[model samples]
Target chain A: MTTTTAAPPGGRAARAAAPSARATGPSTSGRRRLAPWGFLAPAIVLFVLFLALPIGYALYLSFRTEKVSGLGLGSGSRTEVWAGLSNYAAALGDPEFLASVGRVALYGVIVVPTMLGLALLFALLLDSRRARARTFSRTSIFLPYAVPAVISSLLWGFLYLPGVSPFYDLFERFGWDVPSLFDGDLVMFAVANIAVWGGTGFNMIVIYTALKSVPSELYEAAELDGASQVAVALRIKIPIVTPSIIMTAVFSMIATLQVFAEPTTLRPLSNAISTTWTPLMKVYRDAFTRGDLYSAAATSVIIALATFVLSFGFLRLVQSRAFASEK
Target chain B: MRLTTGTRIAALAAATALLASACSGGGDDAGSDDGGSAAGPVELTFWTWTPNMEKVVDLWNSEHPDITVTVNKQDGGDPAITKLLTAIKAGSGAPDIMQAEYQKIPQLVSSDALADLAGSLGDDVAGQFTDGVWDAVTLGSDAVYAVPQDSGPMQFYYRADIFEKLGIDVPTTWDEYADAARKVHEADPKAYLGTFSANDAGWFSGITQQAGASWYGIDGDAWSVDIDSEATTKVAEYWGGLVEEGVIDNKPMYTPEWNAGLNDGTQVGWLSAIWAPGVLAGNAADTAGKWEMAPMPQWDADAPATGAWGGSATAVTSQSEHPEQAAEFITWLNTDPEAVQALVDETGIYPADVPASTEALTDPPEFFSNQPDFYEVAAQTAQTVQPFTYGPNINVAYSAYNDEFAKATKAKTADAFVDAVDAMQQITLDDLKNQGFNVSE
Candidate 1:
């Protein structure tokens, strides 16, 4: 992997300056600077320790490996040595790793658009004047987000089994032989359904909050222009919530690339999902199970780089378009 | 050449700086914890994955007031390894005694994470356990790393009622076993002789062991990896045909569906280790009296052999402050009759203690219809297990098997053996070579 261009120091300075600099009572640069620095110190320190240090260490470890001599029976036979980019090359060349990447790409294609579309629909319904039981529907929809991914996956894993699934009994009663949810062809959609169920509610809340932030005057002017609620929603509400939608999309894309827990938890229920079914799971298998930390570190670095490039490139494209439209 | 040297030097410098900073943060915390409490008792932290481990630790704690041992339960296998590795990398927070599976000992030993216990554990202590279990924890003739705790000797578990109904004798050879699979499935399309769990690599390894396929063996100074040997290929092709003809179910074991199948008589036979009886009895409570045990089928019925599966040992980490005391506890825990009994009562598996006499073995649990004596059968079976050491990165090989098994099972010809050889054996050889081991193919 190539070195990521270092984020600029001036960008931090600009961020530090842009937040409520003019609104502060102290017009003097020194007092205003002191307050922001004090507020930012804890976050900066945390960012360094939890994020930057680990990334740097992984980068360092990715390029180094242990060289063992003789039988490798003991510690004395092994010595840490520099391996350069061999681990990265191996990870890239590996068919299993490439297949996992391809699988996750397909999963993301199925999950993201479907999840965001449902989320947008829910948020619009909650905001609409004709909607009933707003609180009930909102709470019930968002309830799944409260369950941890492992627990949710395990719950769905059982429901996918024919022996235990109510759907199986229901289908059998109707003289319909329902295909197993864990069949190889349907397993991806089954996995994607769990993600969408757990994810859409949270995204809906984000878009709903953004919808609430829209000025009432815009809606009033749209009604004065004799526009229907659907027309107003399509033309005004969605366009205004574009930023939140883009943010959710980017976050989901990053998350989808690093999907590990759902498939791992669902593995015991199905034979179709392999140990290296996802790129992140392969990294996990390499590091812990295989005891090949160097390859794991390199693969993680590759995943991190991919996430950054995809998320940043997406944000940049969306931001430029959003800004252009506003102007 | 100059640029390469410069890069190496730079990388080394960066690594040193990283290590130095980490050391500075954690260097003082180690000696500080032991300072104030030295006069009272030497506290040792132990980690294990077995459920209801508190009883065993509590037994030890009550016996020895001088060294109070604290118990920490971790999820077994990969998670525990990850936690231990993290602790080692950070230079602290490792338990004094932790349980490492036999398959993982080589990997842990290569990392230098385990303490050499040869000095503390003499030949007398080492001689008590079974030879196969002993070799798993030892390096060459000396350098004992862990004490053997338990073993899983492969056994044949089948439904006697079903076999009687089919008028087929219990197959003692692979060829007869294949014939039995065909006859049983042909008789009832709803049932198969047994399942071939695509996800269970350990079971496959055990089968390979039973078939006398030594995938990894130490040859003088190098590790030999021959995963696609004639013996292994024979076993794979045998299973592949059964799977290809739809005589054997290709389902993952230990799932609810598998349990349902076993209980409902859709699965007539199971070939697994001694540890399976407990799980089978629990899952198939309705079919309690129907199951029975026999020696695992062999390549030659005249000379019987079996494979070894899921077993673990108590290993002392290199990070421990009191290695001698830790070794003492581990030895006592495995060798002492009372401790062995307690472990057996808690875990419901036979411990690999000297004399091999425990109530668990002597008294057959009522779950298996009281007809087949579990202890007598397993003890005899354990004796027949061919001693094999799972080489370093064995889990990687197992993961490869699980990853490629579906395709391999689909391929009807000898191509299945080729896939198994590539994924299970070749990948591991390449990985071990990359890790700088001398691998002979």
Candidate 2:
């Protein structure tokens, strides 16, 4: 009931870089840049409309909250009020949000490394001269990536259930005592598996494309040096694809933080996952289900900020090594 | 003022909800300012999730060409309410009328998304619904928000074949129910009598209601939350005990695994609402005729009690340009003898209109054909639905139930269940207080 903050310290969201920068060129003035500007107009308009405008509106909403008088039943009983940093503070202070962050961090730890490692391995195998039926293997591995997270979660959810799972039946037939995927701590792993299964192939394609871009002369030189295939891959292929790996890792990290659909879809099958199992889910619960857009906005901003810092900070930290390795 | 994490979030949410709704309400007034040109038959958009609802609406369209109603089927439950509220906030895209669950009525009313239909609906409409059903729409206030469509009085459904195979009788009391659960699980380790569905807050609320728990109370402008009351704790502990004892499954209901269990005979019974037959028939068609309906196991054998689960009513949105016509459509849709018969015959809902419903239901649902008097038992079950109050922040409370009970069931301890109740009470109370309500601690 107390208005915690007065000045509204941080609602602006930097507002520094306009979404569509003016087409800067050799001349600051004339119609020479007009053709290029016109060509880029569609992309600029889309970025402004879809991305920038929503971000600005969310920023504005995050600074505000409602003031309800009495029962909040009738019109005019509730009025929009300025709520400065309180929503942000509350979001950061919330244990559920913190727990979700922790869950996603753990999920990222499991998903990113395993996905990248497998992707790198597959990319190397596909890049090798001895690789056979490459198209079929590549397509088969990448097939799961085509499945949306919701559908994949549902597919994996059925496979995890004890009542209907063929795996559970198989385990029972073998008389092997396997812990349920939904049991206490295993639910996290169960969800991570879906993300990995759906993500590895895409990352593999990215690294493989980079591997294709690698000069064959380097492979011929390594072969002339009497290097084994494993030696050549580990020494040459992996190093050359490191930049692509770094880019994929950063994308995976951002995707990890923004995870919403998989755990949500799996929720019906497992009792272990809460409504706020991830930060994005909490934001969704707050905004839509609870009808409180302010908190949702603030929480999303926090997530966006976290994503920005983690991704950019990561790029900054690894830029020298990754780019140097590319040379 | 440093507050608890949940309370702080609740406070912020409460504030935004009020502000958003107030803004939308003003916009609603402005958007429709282009004169109510009363020329042609008023076209009303209705959002609902009942299957074959278009058929019933088609029936209305034929009879009353003046008022054309379009049925926009939604995903129903929480998602529909969320979508409606979002539309309300965005100041457009909302339908003329929406199907709202009883628990969600409070949240919708609190958001000012629903219009007051007391003046628009017919005078006799109030008499059509039972007091418990009516209390939900009105919130015990004079302002009528929605007309009752269907009622879901809780019932106990069991697989008779499984019961006979296990040599267990239908449980008549809570103690007997517990005993039967133990025996069933003992007979086959893979099977269970039922499950404690953490995902379904409505089912949990119904259980609490049967134990005589009223979660929220309103007096004047002040609100009181009692989610951790003795009645609720007792019910929670009972289920927790059974689950921890490995008699009842700790997993949720309405899940694929549960559906498979029903088909495979691992799931022996269901503590569900009257509309369960339709769901059972849809989920496990092979198990039909093997299932039978009974009154929920009693706390006291002499004094039976029950609670509503999935019933929903149609309400006119505040954004609607024609409240009168919308109200008229809903009233006829629920109360008219022909429309009520069509709803029962096509929609598979247990109609809330007391008089019209009794007349329409002559035979048992196909899933419960073995029980000659399905509606008879359902009608009797409907009478025992205890009166309970729902507050505007039931969403927060329900979300709290999902969060807290998920942890409790995972822990699989009766003590954890009690702890979960306390957590729900704390979170709900904090949310109410934080939302700037006059909540008494």
Candidate 3:
């Protein structure tokens, strides 16, 4: 009796409501399958137009060069021609480009490690129960993230000026000699400080959020096993947050390589920074100041490739140790 | 699954209608004909990097009632140029007028981004500006792309009280200047005469300009590099000697030490341009009436008294929808006596127009204690400027030379600096050659 009742229209309705109906049944396939595509259509269109189109255009432009016939006096005389690998060769061979890369690499070495280390330390301290004024310190340390990079650079630029600086005044009061932070030897560090100060808090919050995600039960278990808070942090907390740390490090590396805003903003005050101070700066100079967009495009592609390689290379090198247990 | 084919077709039609309208609205706003005379007032967008440009825009707006001019203040020289170039490439959204530096004119002209003003304004407009100003804006034999706005005539500004205390008079020659710097330093071990930033090649460029040297020369279809000329060497050597002598404060500009020096009288003087007086006054406001301007110490007694450091020109873009109105606005802003005077009163920018200068000579600024007529600066600018062509590869040459200068100054060897500059000149020539410039061997 039950079989007969279920086998009627009720069974047909249940079959229609089943998850595999659209995939397996021919009756429902055409009408049901287009919904996902419709949902994704807008986003796919936007992504292609805004992101993919410009990138493809830049790639095309990177392989082109201008040819000027005769005196290049008029519009018809100058024409765009395929350059192949010449622009890339020129960018790679450029001493200025190499110097900028070296300078930025050194800058990243100083900034990334120091900034992330401080951020992690601050985050860990904030997480500690015995730490005093956790709320105040966290807010104050994170306050700089609220300031824009340009504004931060401007503030630091003024502070580096001896006349307006309290540090300079204090040095004078003590009758001690003072050196300029904008000097050739120290300008990189001065720029790095601005980047670190502006970036540390945001990274700290990211790390802290990762730490907060760790269950208190794990800590309880560690404490029960006679492990101290410091030991638990060293053995468990840091290991658990390794993914977040890796993410921040990757981002910081990219930011360091594209160090244009801080140096550009600081330029008006100090004469130490040239037009081609960074790779991105050099790209800007070629594209605009020098009016050689082909070379600029070539250089940009090279830098982007370098960033991708470095990020992945570093990730791969650390991934085994960082996410081994998680996997 | 059981729906009729007609219903599906109707749904598709409705979706197409919605998508078409959305796409059309987006395209319409982005691609509207800028030249069309709409019911509303015509708006012109002007781009400038200078903070003082706001004042200039205000002056222009007050005088022109029919057209509204919108000013977009951008930062960083290179970024502004990038934005301008991108807008031009996009074939729309470009500003009607832009403030371009004199050195940048060559690159802009080469790229065909600027509108040739000479054809519209005629030879009389070119004649109205001083020769140096005119030459800086002209590319090859083509019409001028930019209208001369102001000249950055280099001068030496010193703290009068500090100089008096140290018993140092303004020097006439480089030698005398060095001697005075030494005396000032000896009198007050804590004081240095001026600051030089290693990256700022403007000082070296100004010195070269004063020495009657050109960075590039047109030789048939090719451009010749003259950055390693004897005049350039002389200027580099003189500056190198000053740096080595430890008389000039080696403090990098915009650094904390330099600002401190300005405030507390640690820096005695600085060799700057006409626009510098305003900068110095703003930065060292507490030291008002304490500073005074003097002729820049020449390399030799026979050297010219003036040279440009940095200045900009106003140019109407080729993409401007209202070229006639744009040209009119540029002419009035440049040549009108009242507009020029208002600009000077508002921003301390000396007018490039001779007639405007003549009118401005009547009113002296009280800020400088009425020491000299402010318009006298315009007169000096007119007297000392010499014609110098700005070739297409000028920016590249300038950057190479600046880096070379820094190395030489740091090395404390004039000869080494000259060698470096010559090497850089070669590199610049090579780069330009690759960029399609006809570089002279």
Candidate 4:
């Protein structure tokens, strides 16, 4: 709603300032003074409350520890003391925590590339003119987007069962040895597949929208110059949607870092998935299960900081190319 | 003339204040009690996860026609606790009677969030229930926080036809059990004696309890972890060996593979509690008459004959509007023979009330091929259970042990397995210490 209201006023200002800014340009001080604040307010408010406030709270909590004096006999014996960096040191030194983070990193390595690649391919295919049953294929592929991650994991979990699965049944009919998807080595892939199936369609739609926003005039010019559809898609369309792809990639990375629901839901089906299967899962275990919210809060802050550093570092590295045309 | 920014801020503040005050005023008005209970009928809300509570509610309603009881079907254990905690924190809209698990009873009782039911119920009502059931709901020694609902007596359910086919006898000792399992697997290359889900500590707990492993001791406010004891190690080693020998099917519970094992006869048997029979019936309808119950194998022939698996209790929350009525309903559900019978007839829940089981013992069902003595499981439950203390962080300890057990079982050698268990025990102790549990070195 704000986008609609703000666009008209913003466009008029942009048009008015364009010529003068283009001439004096390097420093559009007048427009820059009003533009940045007006554009940033809504996002800044959300970021402060949802992101910065919680991080600050967690940071404060992480540095504090409960001290129990003289047998901890009563309420008087227990007091809150400043812990400083002990909790962080403990969490980092923990073998279980390190192992869980390593497992998740490996899982992300397997999942992120495969999911984004499939999403990009599907988006390109949907954009192609000669593709058959486009609407049906698009809807079917995107249908999983409507289902919650937990529900999709449950469905896929049942399908992975040797007795219930149609795929397993076919394997049995052919007298082929079908290794259990829930076996120790393969369970990570099973969990990753659930996430990919649930997420790829949504990413595909984002990429597709970005592709659609690309000017058709570019394609027409390429066609007149005797370029193939593949060539146009590779050279023109991809370059145009690079920013969106990077955004999706960064989001996917963040999401993969916080993978909890799929693995948690699938735990009822596989013994290989420990309660501390992922870093977020370990945080949950520490907080609710172990009732060590102090450590849990500390671990969460660590994760949040890692995510911010990773996403920011990535964006900074890619900003020159992806955001170059914006200014 | 320039308008001050303070004036704009004042205008916004005044509007927000007005809106907040109006909302608060409305909330206060609705929260007030119009008159005393003597003038009108009292309506109480009862929240229960067990489906059998509907019949119990119906029985209660018929007895006291003037008082209306609204039974709300809440989701199972963890979600119910979360919902209750949230409602309590919000300071409104909590149910009067909540079904609580035994392990959670200590946490709830210690928090002083539950009403003292012992005063209202008295000895007559409490006397009829088994001591184990009663002890589960008791907080310290004398303060009864809740009333017991059902008993989870662990039993071994095996396929008789499969046992005969494999030429293996029902084992009385752990050694024999392993040998039989090995024989079964040799006979049918794909079959396993039982399934163990590494995440499930309930089954492991039952095994340890049968081996006479106590979790915690209560000697004047001090607590100790007995997980490093010899009995617990023996049980863990036995399970680990089974895993190595491939005698046990390592399928996760509630999975289709587990369900298939139950129905398709890929699994020879399962170690289940009293409630498991009902679960099996509910899940595997096609595998109806193929199942028969046997007692769980002992570590040695002289070991204890029984161990408790899963059970739940009903508690009246501190926020209850009618604590007296809630306590009365819970007392009857736990002790009254007729009420317990009604619940069993309605929900197939094996009642923990000793007197109730005596009366309900004759009821025959076509599900188990008209087995008239279904309550025999209850009798065994009462005889075999040794009291064990469930600590505040028992859930955490259970999960930690479960993960460790999986790791140990999957290990190549017995030494490696023992080392893994030792590591798990140390970590568990450290975790308990961190959570403010009184752990002895």
Candidate 5:
């Protein structure tokens, strides 16, 4: 969703740095000290241009706003003025913005847990020696991540429509009444379903890699002690992959907060999704649709702060409790 | 010091961007200097969404040898306006010509995105369109922002077969329409007269306009919002009551269910605009001969009136080096008899240039071939379209309408509908004040 915005800031610095970095790999001499500097220059440039500049621009824009004079006709009638913290204050006070944040929080709560659980289950199943068609099952589970979010959302959106859905026919055949999976309370679940379908594969692969990296001796020792396969997985494999689970959980939490593509793509199919259905969506609408870039910038800054606090706080909590026994 | 340095670098980058745009503008100046002369060839890019607009532009290109117009097809209405405004802020990449909606003229003008064509166009250009249509581009001022192309004077479209089958008369007034809706629903529980589209803000705005409500009014230099005006509340209550009583469907238009309803003869009537034929043809091709067009049922039958939904004008962007040439092409494209004929034949639009539209739209569209006098009634309805002013904060109000009306439609109550209107008014007014626009209390 933000590929267009992300490209411009990072464009100049991210160009053709790979070849330069690869060519000058840590020449070990005092005389060749400048060689490593040449390699590091590209990454430094990218960080400054992509990360630092955009953040700075957003901060500057958040503190300033347009002052529309009488009628606001002609050029210079709408002039930029120092707004201080007014844009931030307005964003926090806006009911619509608050509603959007709350909705995304609900969406995150639905998506993250369900997605991680399915991913873990799939990983555990594939890791068992008794499992058959392992490669086929693994590929199929991981395939959805290859499809972009927007495309998957559209696919699910059509299936959710009663007039076009095969499920509609099945429901009628069963003599049951099921309304559209859009609008009202049902839309949140509909959006979360698409996210889980598209996201589970990637998370599954992460857990699978962590499972493979675990020593086989632990499972053997558990089995020799008369533990079942389920017992072995629950006790040995699960405990070993706690860090990977935490990593994936943190990533999913961040992605959940920044859920833009699925809801935006499904918007035309349902009136349930507002322009400010999510905080990122709210920023897009305010900046592009309402033509209020200052408020949009402020909202972005606030959302960024929230994402940092939430994800880092979760990491701190997990490290304290989940890793205390391991340490 | 480092934080201030970040601010300084950011400011420098912005200045560099502005300078880069200024340099590009200089380049276009050089290119357009040659364009000013008849001997030099000029190329112009136009962005529009009207179907088969390229054929109309081809006629212009053939007749005018020195100037070449390239049509870049875009998504209609709001998306196109959004892109244009984005380009305007970025200070580059806007097309030489743009398709501007009537409601967005003030926003564009205030943003300084559109070039006012007061000096570029001929005096006769103002006389080509109705005063109401002309005033839309000008914002009650003398500066012309765009050349009027098409006008959507809304009319009622109904299934004549369904009306006849139910033994109901074609409704002529708002009260009769409600009675007919109830009768139709009673005869067949699956069917409805029409649906109240919560998603379609323009559809609701047009209905409000038809009810003698102007949501925005400009006095002196201040803008006043009236979304909660008595006329609009009355209009909302009328639809809300029907929905609440389960006579009218609460489903939105342009949805798959609505399309299925149309195909199955469960949605009997549509309150839509002049371009309804194309949409009907696309959605429910099987219902071709069964449908018919009529004037929108009047609030007071003694004085008939209607409102606009979707129409756009040909505008020149401020970034365009050759506003005069762009204006000339637009004028000829909209008003020239040959160009208008080609436009009508190719794009299937109801031209806003009154004389050209009258001359070109002699025959009915293919989808409504059952009614030979379709354009005749359309021409008459076009004349009765009421004038409405648009403010800069229209986007804010439209989004609010979507959110509030969705809830109201779900609640299915007349009171909720009225409250939705109140919410829209408050949101729009607050937005204007927050954006620092001078708004009257």
Candidate 6:
């Protein structure tokens, strides 16, 4: 469930290290190694306690299940039984799990591209000199990031309702018929819109910052060669920010894979989303709602592994291309 | 790179150490050898999601100054269960007492997270509640895991004004209900008899129970699951036909759209549990005095039956240091007249007591047109509700039903409902068998 939250904190440390790695290239590495390790002891202790322990325990639980002997009426009757690979086999073969995977894959296809494209567009707009109300627009686009996913889904859920929605009221006035947003086909877009709204801003900020880091002389050099502002942005600005864009895409994909809060919060308003709407929600249903911790643990491990492969695969693809030119 | 790798390895080793410590420290600190009667003031923690429960807790605290209880409000539904499970698995942070829904009792019992109160409480304790309510908390004949706090017997609430306008009397049988639904829809294109919420799996479960569908039954030591029985299929076909015919709007409940439908008379009635009156009263105050309650429409004209829906009980966790005191509090809170009355007065939760608290039956809120007749009808319905057992896999079964119901509603087909129920029954049966329980169709 917290697959999204787990990535961000770890991502923050990497983000913090990116520029500094270049700044302190070969200097002061060996001299302060022990001192830095001593200083990092508390963080290491906390990281171990909070993150690694829970993960290790989930892995251990994924391989074992509770078996009921007689009646299953008392504590003595139920015993933990080791069932190697069975839970994973069950999760993999389950049609519901496969359906959830398909739904999330479709969701990712819609959300990631739309969100990144809009973020790139907005970042370029903000970096341009002639843009109007840049501060207001930037803040407005990024504002949703401050609102939690649950709250934004709730806010959008109301706006999507026919009776309470101003948009529905407007549509009626215009004599235009519109289907309810909570209907089966349209509900996915409604959910995807919420994710895109909440995400584009943060990714925009990351890309915008990366665009700012590119030397002004590069743009000046391009402009001197009879280049337009769009040409400079499309060629010079975008390529320089490829690493940041790739990082954002990886993070967005990870978040999209674990879409729980939006669909869950929207459920009270829409019937389109089931309790097992996403893989993470399914894992949660198994663990707490069904009290099948072993199945839940196995599902989570599967999700975590999927995320690892997707993120690393993208990073490796981008690294080979980007670094080949650098070398 | 070297520094980063070193820190990462150090973090990994530290995490391993933390996990090892957690494993070794799994034993319960509150040993039963400490004796039941602990001296001095015992501070007990209680968690519940029911709003306005403060008055009940306050009354209990005032009465038992020696055993002060702290009330903490947790979120309802799956999230609350998640918190409880995490606390239990962590071997700490569990509240002594918590509110558990009736359907969740079997699951919690299987987890070994609850203490058996049958041995500690007197024999008369189980007899205080109605049969349906008592069976919800009791494992068999002897083992009681929780105290029945409130109940929701299925009831039909209709818009009296709308029925009069449509020139129709209240429906006594489901056939008449369907005819009225069609007439109401034909009379006003904007209105329907009721909205069918496909997402509301629990409500459908209750209706099926009313139709004499026993989804879960304990036969000796094994569990019998029949989710797609004749009765259940009948219910599914009836509702699925209603959806397909446009006699009912397939809208999700508890949303703004549903509320607007009620307030504006687009939806004429709600077929739900006794809790419907309170919810409708709170959400659509403009429709006050225009609504009336009746016993749920029967599947057969000669049969007088109902089903149970949402109700909760106070259960003692296994981690509690003072089980006897906790049981005493739970029993007193549920059975004692003052505490039960306080709960009704504060939260509008109808008591599950057999005799029916006088205060609950007598007091008529103005929101229901100042009529207390519904209370008596509700109490009678509560008594007539079919007693059934919820399996440990009930939640999973519920979600599976919800998934299938949603598909059936969307596809507008009776066959879809049958297929959904078939898949649900098969999934749960396999799951139980895999879990080492003797499950049979």
Q: What is the C-alpha RMSD of each candidate to the true structure, in Å?
A: 9.2, 10.9, 7.8, 8.9, 8.8, 9.0
Q: On residues B44-147, what C-alpha lDDT tens digit does candidate 1 reach at each position? A: 88888887777887899898988778889898766887678667666777788988888888878876789999899856787777777888898555789899
Per-residue lDDT for B271 in model 6?
Answer: 92
Clashing pairs in 1: none
Q: Write the per-residue lDDT of candidate 3 for residues B155-194, one digit (tens) a residue.
A: 7788888888777888877788889888888888888887
Model 6: per-residue Cα lDDT over B310-412, one tens digit each:
9889999988888888999998888888888888888888887665475546756567755667677776777788867788878778888777777777787
What tens-digit string does per-residue lDDT give for candidate 2 at B1-441?
011122223234444444454465455464354336776778888999999999999999999988999999999777889888877775876889899999988878887899999889777889988999999999999999999999999999999988988889999888999999999888888888899988899999998899899999987888889988899999999998988888999888888888899998899999999999988999999998999999999998899999878799999998888888889999999899999999999999999999999999989998888999888999999999999888889999888999999999889999999999999999888877766767765
Stretches > 4 Å off in candidate 1 = A1-36, A212-237, A319-321, B1-41, B57-63, B165-168, B358-360, B409-414
> Residue A311 in model 4: shift from native, Å?
1.3
Angstrom error at residue B335, model 5: 0.6
Q: What TM-score does candidate 3 get on C-alpha atoms?
A: 0.84
Ranking 3 against 5 by DockQ, winner: 3
lDDT over C-alpha atoms for residue A33 of model 3: 74
Pull out the clashing pairs in model 6: none
TM per candidate: 0.87, 0.91, 0.84, 0.84, 0.91, 0.89
Per-candidate chain B TM: 0.91, 0.93, 0.86, 0.87, 0.93, 0.92
> What fraction of the reference interface contacts is present in each model, in order?
0.45, 0.47, 0.21, 0.22, 0.38, 0.41
How far in Å is the alpha carbon of B268 misplaced in model 2? Answer: 0.6
State the weakest 10-residue window (summed lDDT) of model 4 chain B: B1-10
Mark the 10 consecutive residues where model 5 chain A has the least summed lDDT. Answer: A22-31
lDDT of each: 0.80, 0.86, 0.74, 0.73, 0.86, 0.81
Q: lDDT per residue, candidate 4, B310-370, as tens digits?
A: 7888889876767787787778776777787788788777777777777875654445663
Candidate ranking (DockQ, best to worst): 3, 6, 1, 5, 2, 4
The C-alpha stretches of model 3 lying farther than 4 A from their native spots are A1-28, A69-74, A172-178, A198-225, A269-272, B1-80, B122-126, B139-142, B254-260, B302-304, B321-325, B336-339, B373-381, B406-416
Taking candidate 2, what TM-score does its chain B reach relative to the real chain B?
0.93
TM-score of chain A of each: 0.86, 0.88, 0.90, 0.82, 0.88, 0.86
Per-residue C-alpha lDDT of model 5 across residues B243-266, encoded as one tens digit per residue: 899999887678777888889998
| True-vs-predicted CA distance for residue B221, candidate 2, Å | 0.9
